[model samples]
Target: MVAAADAQNYAQKLGIIHGLVVQELGWDEDTNDDLRAEIEETIGSELLDEDSDEVMDVVLLWWRDGDGDLVDALMEVTGQLSDEGFVWVLTPKTGNSGHVDPSEIAESAPPAGFTQTSAISLGEWAGSRLVQPKAPSKQR
Candidate 1:
C-alpha cells in the first residue's frame, strides 16, 4: 500500500512539473489554469515531503527565445515552494554563441543559486519556430 501511494504521489508531482513546462509554452488559458491548479494541489498535499528547514533545489533552463517572463514564472513557482521549506537552483538557458554572455542575466537580480548555462544554438532555436506543418489543401 505504501509503495502504491508513493507511486501515485510521484506521478502527480511529475504532472505538475510538466504542467509548468506546458504553461511556459503559452498553452491555452483553460489548459494553463487546469495545470496550475493541479500543480498547486500536489505541492500543497505534502508530496515533496521536505522538512521546514530543508532547502529545495530547483533548476530552470529557458530556451534561447525565452525572455524574462520565463525566469519570472520560475521565480514565482520557486517562491511558493520556498514557503514550504524548499530552495531553487534556477539555471536560465543561454545561446551557444561564443560572443553571447550569460552574466547579463545573472546580474539582473536573478533568484539565489540561479546559474546560466549554454543551451541549444540560437539558430536552432529560431529555426524551430519556422518549421511548422502545412495545412491540407482546400478542395475546389
Candidate 2:
C-alpha cells in the first residue's frame, strides 16, 4: 500500500482535500482505493461512508461507464452534494474502457443540477469537476 503522504500527494495534485469527501465508486479499482486512502489522510479521517446520509463538501466520483452509465451516475449522486459541495467525476482519460468525452459531460451536467466546471487529467483518467450551484452553505 502506498503511504498516506503519497496518497495525499496525488490528491493534492488533483486539487482534492476539503471537508467531508464523499467517495462514490463508479470505477472501483485499486487506483481509486489509493486515491481514497490519500483523501482520507488529507482530511485526517475516514471519508463519509456511502450509507451515512450526510451532506459532503467534496465528492470523489470514480466512474468507469463508457457511454450509457453517466446518466445513472449523475442522477444517483447529484442530490448528495451540499449546496457548495463539488463532485469530481473521474473517468478514463481516453484509451481506457470507460473514457467519457468532454462534450458528453457538458450535455449531461445541467439536468442533474450540476455545472461542469473544469477538466482534470489524472494518472489513468480524466476528471470533470461538477458543482451544484443552488445547494445551501457547506459544512467544510
Candidate 3:
C-alpha cells in the first residue's frame, strides 16, 4: 500500500483519464481500501465490478506476480474493453514480494489480443497500459 501522499499522486494520475472506470482491484485489503477511496474521490467516475452488458472506456486491473493463471485473467478482461478502451495493468514493483517482470507482460499481452502502449510508474505500482492491437491495413 502507498502512503498518503503517494495515494494522492496515484489519484491524480487516474483523474486525468476520462471515461467509465472498471476496476478489478485485486489487491489485499490494506492497499485496496486506500486506493479505492483515493481513486473514487479523485476520479469521480462510474465504476463497474463484474461483466455485464456495458463496456467501459478504461479498466484498472491490479495484478501481482504468481497470483495465478494470468492467461485466464487476460482472456476474461479482453471482452470487457470497448474498441477504443484501454486496460492499465498495475503490478508490484521489482524487489516487492509480488512483483511481476515487465518481460512477461511484453510476452503475454499480445497473445491475449492486446498491445502494450506504454509503461508508467504509479507510486508503489508499475503500470502498463494495454490496448486492442491495431489491425494490419489491406494492401493498396
Candidate 4:
C-alpha cells in the first residue's frame, strides 16, 4: 500500500477535492517496535488536537492495480467508523479498463447518499442528472 503522504500527493495530482491524508497504522507490517510506537504517538496527536474537528466525510479510493487485502482492511476500518460520518469507496469496475465505479458494498450499511456518476470529474458528470428526495403522496 502507498504511504499516506504519497497517496495524498497523488490525489492532489488527480485534482481530487477535500482529500485529507490518513495513515492506517494497522496496514503496516515491516515496522519495528520503535517505529510502531512513534506512529501511534503521531496518530494520537493528530486525533486529539484541539483545533481538529470530528471527521465528517471520508473517501477511500483503491486501485485494481493494488492488493485486494488492502481493500478489505479499509472496509473493516470504515465499519468501525460508520457512525461518525459518511464513507465512500471508489473501486475499479470489473472487466473495465481500470475505470473506477463508486458503489455501496454493504446494503445494510450504505453510505448516507450513494449514487452513480458518469465520470469521476465531479461537475462534468453532475449536471446530466437531477437528484432529489422523493416527495410524499397526497392522501385521499
The TM-score values for the models, in the order shown, are: 0.25, 0.75, 0.75, 0.27
For residue 42, model 3's alpha carbon misses the true position, in angstroms, by 4.1
Using TM-score as the yardstick, the better of models 2 and 4 is 2
**Per-residue lDDT for 1-140 in model 1, tens only?**
24464444422433234322211322222222433355555445332322233344322223232334444644544433332222222222244332223454444324532333322222212111101123377999
TM-score of 3: 0.75
Off by over 4 Å in 1: 1-56, 66-71, 83-100, 110-140
After best superposition, candidate 2 residue 65: deviation in angstroms? 2.8
lDDT of 2 at 5: 59
Off by over 4 Å in 3: 1-19, 30-35, 51-53, 136-140
Q: Which tens-of-lDDT digit does each residue in 1-140 have in candidate 3? A: 44576344555565434335656546564244555666665557545566455666667778888777665677687776777777778888888778999988888787788888888877677888888876787998
RMSD to the true structure for each prediction, in A, is: 18.6, 5.1, 4.8, 11.9
**C-alpha lDDT score of every prediction, in listed order:** 0.32, 0.70, 0.70, 0.32
Q: Clash totals for all models, in order?
A: 3, 2, 0, 0
- What lDDT tens digits, residue by residue, belong to model 2 across residues 1-140? 45575444656765765555565555454345666677777777777656767777777767665436575677777566776678887777777677767787787888777888888676777778888777466898
**Could you tell me which residue pairs clash in candidate 1?**
56-86, 56-87, 58-89
After superposition on all CA atoms, how large is the RMSD of candidate 1?
Answer: 18.6
